[model samples]
Target: MQFICLIYNAEDNGPQPGTDEFGPYMQAYADYTQEVQDAGVMVGGEALQPIATATTVSVRDGKTELMDGPFAETKEQLGGYYILDCKDLDEALKYAAKIPDAKYGRVEVRPVMVFD
Candidate 1:
């Protein structure tokens, strides 16, 4: 089975670049990634650009519409994600808890749906 860990945090929250804690914060993520990879559970993961760089698109009434940034403002924003191969949801949640962001933000673990 596979699970996707959706990482969410406030854009202005957490350690920011040019700050003293930034380097260590990033290192923590690297260490977590390596730990998962070494354990053979990490399928893939990546950090996304800030929400300010996001573009939203929708189609209604046979017309295409584009919106800048997120459709709704929220305290937390989707920052990144990790796809992991795990034995089950229990295992996936275990790994999700290890994510660095889990401390200050949230890591939503959801089982991947397969079509056959």
Candidate 2:
């Protein structure tokens, strides 16, 4: 089974701290990535640009509507994601908990739906 771990955090919190604070965060992630990679669980992952750079689109009445920013406004914004191959939801949850954001924000672990 595969799952996507969606990382979310507050945009108002501003850019993550510089080298001082960021160093620990990066080290934590590096450790987690290495552990998962060693276990053959990590498939892929990436960090996303800020929400301010996002564009939203919707279609209604046969017309396409384009709007600036994310689909919704919230204190927490989707910041990145990790796609993992896991034995099950429980295993995925364990991995999600290791994400640094899980301490201050949220890491939503959702299974991927595959179409036959």
Candidate 3:
């Protein structure tokens, strides 16, 4: 089974790490990535830029609309995501909890859909 882990955090709050905190924070992520890779669970993942840089698009009445920011204005934004291959939802949740942002933000785990 494949799951998509949507990471969310406050854009204004920025990353919690400071100059000194960066090393450990990065190390933790590196370690987690390695562990999941060694287990053959990691499919793909990446950190995203701030919502301020996002462009939202919508189509209505055969017309296209473009907005300067994210689709919605919220304190927490869609920061990044991880797609993983796991045994089940429970297993995916376990891995999601290991994400560094899980302590301050949220990690939403959803099953991926497959089409024939």
lDDT against true structure, model 2: 0.88
How well is each residue in 51-76 modelled by candidate 2, as lDDT tens digits? 88999999999999999999978889
Where in model 2 is the C-alpha error above 4 Å? Answer: 12-15
lDDT (0 to 1) per candidate: 0.92, 0.88, 0.88
Candidate 1 minimal-lDDT segment of 10 residues: 70-79
Best by lDDT: 1
Tens-place lDDT digits, model 3, residues 14-84: 34556676688778889988988998999999999978799999999999999999997888899889899
Query: In terms of TM-score, how similar is model 1 to the real structure?
Result: 0.95
Give the candidate order by descending TM-score: 1, 3, 2
Q: Per-residue lDDT tens digits of candidate 1, residues 28-88?
A: 9999999999999999999999899999999999999999998768999999999999998
TM-score of each: 0.95, 0.90, 0.92
Better of 1 and 2 by lDDT: 1
Which pairs of residues collide in candidate 2?
none
By TM-score, is 1 or 2 better? 1
For each candidate in turn, give its C-alpha RMSD to the true structure in angstroms. 0.9, 1.7, 1.5
Looking at candidate 3, the ten consecutive residues that score lowest on lDDT are 11-20
